[model samples]
Target: MAFVRVAALSQLPEGGALGVEAAGRRIAVARVDGEVYAFADNCSHRDFPLSHGEVDAAARTITCEWHGAAFCLLTGEPTCAPAFRPIAIYPAKVEDGAVWVEIADEPAPAEKAGGLRSLGI
Candidate 1:
Protein backbone atom coordinates (compact mmCIF):
# COMPACT_ATOMS: atom_id res chain seq x y z
CA MET A 1 0.00 0.00 0.00
CA ALA A 2 1.22 3.48 -0.84
CA PHE A 3 0.07 7.03 -0.87
CA VAL A 4 -1.82 7.88 -4.03
CA ARG A 5 -2.49 11.37 -5.24
CA VAL A 6 -6.22 11.99 -5.52
CA ALA A 7 -6.67 15.69 -6.11
CA ALA A 8 -4.74 18.92 -6.06
CA LEU A 9 -5.07 20.68 -2.76
CA SER A 10 -6.26 23.75 -4.60
CA GLN A 11 -9.14 21.78 -6.12
CA LEU A 12 -10.61 20.93 -2.73
CA PRO A 13 -12.77 23.71 -1.34
CA GLU A 14 -12.37 24.76 2.24
CA GLY A 15 -15.00 23.34 4.60
CA GLY A 16 -16.16 20.82 2.03
CA ALA A 17 -15.85 17.19 1.00
CA LEU A 18 -14.77 15.86 -2.37
CA GLY A 19 -15.30 12.36 -3.72
CA VAL A 20 -12.29 10.55 -5.19
CA GLU A 21 -11.20 7.05 -6.10
CA ALA A 22 -8.07 5.53 -4.67
CA ALA A 23 -7.11 1.94 -5.35
CA GLY A 24 -10.60 1.46 -6.65
CA ARG A 25 -12.08 2.50 -3.33
CA ARG A 26 -14.59 5.33 -3.10
CA ILE A 27 -13.23 7.93 -0.73
CA ALA A 28 -14.37 11.24 0.62
CA VAL A 29 -11.69 13.84 1.19
CA ALA A 30 -12.59 16.74 3.44
CA ARG A 31 -10.84 19.90 4.46
CA VAL A 32 -11.64 21.36 7.82
CA ASP A 33 -9.85 24.14 9.65
CA GLY A 34 -6.84 23.80 7.33
CA GLU A 35 -6.54 20.07 7.98
CA VAL A 36 -7.53 17.32 5.58
CA TYR A 37 -9.31 14.06 6.40
CA ALA A 38 -10.26 11.05 4.31
CA PHE A 39 -12.93 8.43 4.79
CA ALA A 40 -15.21 6.13 2.87
CA ASP A 41 -17.53 8.12 0.68
CA ASN A 42 -20.53 5.87 1.25
CA CYS A 43 -22.76 6.35 4.22
CA SER A 44 -22.88 3.38 6.58
CA HIS A 45 -26.64 3.46 6.91
CA ARG A 46 -27.36 3.95 3.26
CA ASP A 47 -25.64 3.78 -0.12
CA PHE A 48 -25.28 7.52 -0.42
CA PRO A 49 -22.17 9.48 -1.07
CA LEU A 50 -20.91 11.42 1.87
CA SER A 51 -19.41 13.98 -0.49
CA HIS A 52 -22.94 15.00 -1.41
CA GLY A 53 -23.59 16.02 2.18
CA GLU A 54 -22.95 19.09 4.28
CA VAL A 55 -19.76 19.74 6.15
CA ASP A 56 -19.62 21.43 9.51
CA ALA A 57 -16.08 22.74 9.78
CA ALA A 58 -16.47 24.00 13.30
CA ALA A 59 -18.05 20.77 14.51
CA ARG A 60 -15.72 18.58 12.40
CA THR A 61 -18.61 16.58 11.05
CA ILE A 62 -20.07 15.58 7.69
CA THR A 63 -23.79 15.02 7.47
CA CYS A 64 -25.40 12.65 5.01
CA GLU A 65 -28.07 14.47 3.11
CA TRP A 66 -30.13 11.42 2.26
CA HIS A 67 -30.97 10.45 5.82
CA GLY A 68 -29.50 13.12 8.07
CA ALA A 69 -26.73 10.95 9.41
CA ALA A 70 -23.65 12.85 10.59
CA PHE A 71 -20.16 11.47 11.01
CA CYS A 72 -17.04 12.87 12.58
CA LEU A 73 -14.43 13.93 10.04
CA LEU A 74 -11.50 12.88 12.19
CA THR A 75 -12.71 9.52 13.49
CA GLY A 76 -15.43 8.60 10.99
CA GLU A 77 -17.67 7.76 13.90
CA PRO A 78 -21.33 8.47 13.48
CA THR A 79 -22.45 11.47 15.49
CA CYS A 80 -26.13 11.00 14.63
CA ALA A 81 -28.53 8.42 13.30
CA PRO A 82 -29.99 6.76 11.36
CA ALA A 83 -26.38 5.60 11.39
CA PHE A 84 -24.88 3.55 14.13
CA ARG A 85 -21.83 2.29 12.26
CA PRO A 86 -18.67 4.23 11.69
CA ILE A 87 -17.20 4.71 8.23
CA ALA A 88 -13.77 3.52 7.23
CA ILE A 89 -11.10 6.17 7.57
CA TYR A 90 -7.91 6.29 5.57
CA PRO A 91 -4.67 8.13 6.13
CA ALA A 92 -4.39 11.35 4.17
CA LYS A 93 -2.07 14.31 3.81
CA VAL A 94 -1.35 17.31 1.67
CA GLU A 95 2.06 17.71 0.11
CA ASP A 96 3.42 19.46 -2.92
CA GLY A 97 0.05 21.12 -3.35
CA ALA A 98 -1.67 17.74 -3.78
CA VAL A 99 -3.92 15.57 -1.63
CA TRP A 100 -2.54 12.10 -1.06
CA VAL A 101 -4.33 9.10 0.44
CA GLU A 102 -2.78 5.90 1.66
CA ILE A 103 -4.61 2.87 0.38
CA ALA A 104 -3.97 -0.47 1.94
CA ASP A 105 -3.45 -3.55 -0.18
CA GLU A 106 -5.24 -5.69 2.37
CA PRO A 107 -7.33 -5.04 5.41
CA ALA A 108 -5.66 -2.57 7.76
CA PRO A 109 -3.98 -3.95 10.85
CA ALA A 110 -6.85 -2.80 12.99
CA GLU A 111 -9.33 -4.31 10.62
CA LYS A 112 -7.49 -7.61 10.66
CA ALA A 113 -7.63 -7.68 14.41
CA GLY A 114 -11.37 -7.32 14.80
CA GLY A 115 -12.78 -6.44 11.41
CA LEU A 116 -14.15 -2.98 10.66
CA ARG A 117 -17.70 -3.48 11.84
CA SER A 118 -16.75 -5.68 14.75
CA LEU A 119 -14.49 -2.99 16.18
CA GLY A 120 -17.23 -0.40 15.74
CA ILE A 121 -15.34 1.37 12.96
Candidate 2:
Protein backbone atom coordinates (compact mmCIF):
# COMPACT_ATOMS: atom_id res chain seq x y z
CA MET A 1 0.00 0.00 0.00
CA ALA A 2 1.06 3.54 -0.79
CA PHE A 3 -0.11 6.97 0.26
CA VAL A 4 -2.14 8.84 -2.34
CA ARG A 5 -3.17 12.47 -2.39
CA VAL A 6 -6.87 12.88 -1.68
CA ALA A 7 -7.68 16.48 -0.89
CA ALA A 8 -6.31 19.82 0.24
CA LEU A 9 -6.18 20.31 3.97
CA SER A 10 -7.98 23.61 3.65
CA GLN A 11 -10.91 21.93 1.96
CA LEU A 12 -11.63 19.74 4.98
CA PRO A 13 -13.24 21.97 7.57
CA GLU A 14 -12.86 21.36 11.26
CA GLY A 15 -15.04 18.43 12.45
CA GLY A 16 -16.08 17.63 8.89
CA ALA A 17 -16.04 14.53 6.73
CA LEU A 18 -15.63 14.17 3.01
CA GLY A 19 -16.10 11.23 0.66
CA VAL A 20 -13.55 10.77 -2.07
CA GLU A 21 -12.46 8.09 -4.50
CA ALA A 22 -9.05 6.49 -4.03
CA ALA A 23 -7.62 3.26 -5.34
CA GLY A 24 -10.91 2.66 -7.11
CA ARG A 25 -12.73 2.63 -3.79
CA ARG A 26 -14.76 5.17 -1.88
CA ILE A 27 -12.89 6.60 1.11
CA ALA A 28 -14.18 8.80 3.91
CA VAL A 29 -11.82 11.49 5.12
CA ALA A 30 -12.62 13.31 8.33
CA ARG A 31 -11.02 16.27 10.02
CA VAL A 32 -10.99 16.26 13.78
CA ASP A 33 -9.28 18.87 15.91
CA GLY A 34 -6.88 19.60 13.05
CA GLU A 35 -6.00 15.98 12.33
CA VAL A 36 -7.28 13.91 9.43
CA TYR A 37 -8.59 10.34 9.47
CA ALA A 38 -9.54 8.10 6.58
CA PHE A 39 -11.83 5.05 6.49
CA ALA A 40 -14.29 3.16 4.35
CA ASP A 41 -17.01 5.54 3.17
CA ASN A 42 -19.99 3.21 3.61
CA CYS A 43 -21.73 2.54 6.86
CA SER A 44 -21.69 -1.02 8.09
CA HIS A 45 -25.35 -0.93 9.07
CA ARG A 46 -27.09 0.11 5.89
CA ASP A 47 -24.43 1.04 3.38
CA PHE A 48 -25.02 4.77 3.83
CA PRO A 49 -22.28 7.28 3.11
CA LEU A 50 -20.68 8.23 6.42
CA SER A 51 -19.57 11.54 4.95
CA HIS A 52 -23.13 12.78 5.33
CA GLY A 53 -22.97 12.29 9.08
CA GLU A 54 -22.02 14.66 11.86
CA VAL A 55 -18.55 14.65 13.35
CA ASP A 56 -17.59 15.21 16.96
CA ALA A 57 -14.00 16.30 17.08
CA ALA A 58 -13.69 16.00 20.81
CA ALA A 59 -15.08 12.49 20.95
CA ARG A 60 -13.52 11.50 17.63
CA THR A 61 -16.79 10.03 16.45
CA ILE A 62 -18.99 10.39 13.39
CA THR A 63 -22.74 9.89 13.80
CA CYS A 64 -24.43 8.48 10.75
CA GLU A 65 -27.52 10.47 9.89
CA TRP A 66 -29.27 7.53 8.29
CA HIS A 67 -29.57 5.26 11.34
CA GLY A 68 -27.90 7.20 14.14
CA ALA A 69 -24.86 4.96 14.22
CA ALA A 70 -21.76 6.54 15.70
CA PHE A 71 -18.26 5.31 14.88
CA CYS A 72 -14.85 6.21 16.11
CA LEU A 73 -12.97 8.20 13.52
CA LEU A 74 -9.64 7.06 14.86
CA THR A 75 -10.36 3.34 15.03
CA GLY A 76 -13.37 2.94 12.76
CA GLU A 77 -15.10 0.94 15.48
CA PRO A 78 -18.75 1.44 16.09
CA THR A 79 -19.40 3.60 19.11
CA CYS A 80 -23.15 3.06 19.15
CA ALA A 81 -25.80 0.60 18.15
CA PRO A 82 -27.16 -0.37 14.72
CA ALA A 83 -23.61 -1.01 13.60
CA PHE A 84 -21.40 -3.71 15.03
CA ARG A 85 -18.85 -4.21 12.28
CA PRO A 86 -15.96 -1.81 12.08
CA ILE A 87 -15.22 0.02 8.89
CA ALA A 88 -11.83 -0.43 7.24
CA ILE A 89 -9.37 2.24 8.33
CA TYR A 90 -6.41 3.63 6.49
CA PRO A 91 -3.37 5.59 7.53
CA ALA A 92 -3.75 9.29 6.86
CA LYS A 93 -1.20 12.08 6.90
CA VAL A 94 -0.88 15.70 5.93
CA GLU A 95 1.95 17.00 3.80
CA ASP A 96 2.47 20.53 2.53
CA GLY A 97 -1.20 21.37 3.07
CA ALA A 98 -2.47 18.24 1.31
CA VAL A 99 -4.11 15.17 2.77
CA TRP A 100 -2.80 11.76 1.80
CA VAL A 101 -4.27 8.37 2.64
CA GLU A 102 -2.64 4.97 2.44
CA ILE A 103 -4.81 2.48 0.60
CA ALA A 104 -4.11 -1.13 -0.26
CA ASP A 105 -4.34 -2.13 -3.89
CA GLU A 106 -6.93 -4.80 -4.69
CA PRO A 107 -7.06 -6.94 -7.78
CA ALA A 108 -9.78 -6.07 -10.29
CA PRO A 109 -12.83 -8.36 -10.47
CA ALA A 110 -11.98 -9.56 -13.94
CA GLU A 111 -8.48 -10.48 -12.90
CA LYS A 112 -9.79 -12.30 -9.85
CA ALA A 113 -12.22 -14.22 -12.03
CA GLY A 114 -9.56 -15.47 -14.44
CA GLY A 115 -10.22 -13.09 -17.32
CA LEU A 116 -8.48 -13.44 -20.71
CA ARG A 117 -5.41 -11.73 -19.38
CA SER A 118 -5.00 -14.57 -16.91
CA LEU A 119 -4.60 -17.08 -19.77
CA GLY A 120 -1.09 -18.55 -19.97
CA ILE A 121 -0.04 -17.39 -23.45
Best by TM-score: 1
| lDDT (tens digit, per residue) of candidate 1 on 1-121 | 8999999999899998899987877888999887999988888776588999999988999999888989988787889878777788889999999999998998554334332332233
| Model 1 spans > 4 angstroms off | 108-121
Model 2: per-residue Cα lDDT over 40-119, one tens digit each: 78777777888999998889999988889898987777898877777777889999999999877864332233321212
> RMSD for each model, in Å, please?
3.6, 8.5
TM-score of each candidate structure, all chains considered together: 0.87, 0.85
Candidate 1 whole-model C-alpha lDDT, 0 to 1: 0.83
Collision count for each candidate, in order: 0, 0
